[model samples]
Target: MTWWPEARDELARLWVEDTSRQQIAEAADEIDRVLAVDPEARGEPGPEGFRRLTIRPLTVQFAVEEPDRMVIVVTVRLLTD
Candidate 1:
């Protein structure tokens, strides 16, 4: 399982500031699970489409571009609502 440098750094920072780091870690693990199940699961199509996988209150938006064999995570954030 590989992550882009930016995503890695963002997650690291999230862990640093968020008191619920463990929860976020679990959410990340769930994202891995979704990836394992469907590497091609790009979320709802749109102008800026990405695979939207959620672990409870957190939302992970990403896209799987096969040619490069990369999971492009556009954003990882906690859902306020």
Candidate 2:
């Protein structure tokens, strides 16, 4: 089944205005691709059915909805000190 992944509002904002805008966009693209195929196999399972995946300077939390074939990317944040 195909999956539709959506980044949350804050993450989308980061894509447009953050200094690491380019990288954030690229990471979101990759998240869509990876989650599309086999979401269950991609991220490490987290609490309450959420999963976490890290791509470079960002880490995203996502959940798969089997009935809707959707992947909701609930959180995306830059890894900063």
Candidate 3:
């Protein structure tokens, strides 16, 4: 069961800072790996078909489309520095 985890344009803003960008990028990579393997088993469920996942300073909202074999990440946020 492979899934393609995609980040939306809305997440680009969080990568502006050099420091945060590296951290976020690393986290994003890990996110893709995890989501690709098993998205439904992870993350906290949210309303309106959205799911929330937090990787340290980054929090992301993604929706898993089983039929499409994709996890569409809709939003991203940095919790701290």
TM-score of 3: 0.76
| Candidate 1, backbone clash total | 1
Worst window of 10 by summed lDDT in candidate 2: 1-10
Clashing pairs counted in every model: 1, 0, 0
Candidate 1 TM-score to native: 0.72
Worst 10 residues of 3 by lDDT: 1-10
Off by over 4 Å in 3: 1-7
All candidates: CA RMSD (Å): 2.4, 3.2, 3.5
Model 1: lDDT of residue 24: 83
Best by TM-score: 2
Candidate 2 ranges beyond 4 A from true positions: 1-7
lDDT digits (tens) for residues 1-81 of candidate 1: 456677777777887888888988888887777676556643455346556766764676677777765666666777656
Error of 1 at 41 (Å): 3.8
- lDDT per residue for candidate 2 within 25-55, as digits (tens), equals 7876787888888888898988888899888
lDDT of each: 0.69, 0.75, 0.72
TM-score of each: 0.72, 0.78, 0.76
Ranking by TM-score: 2, 3, 1
lDDT of 1: 0.69
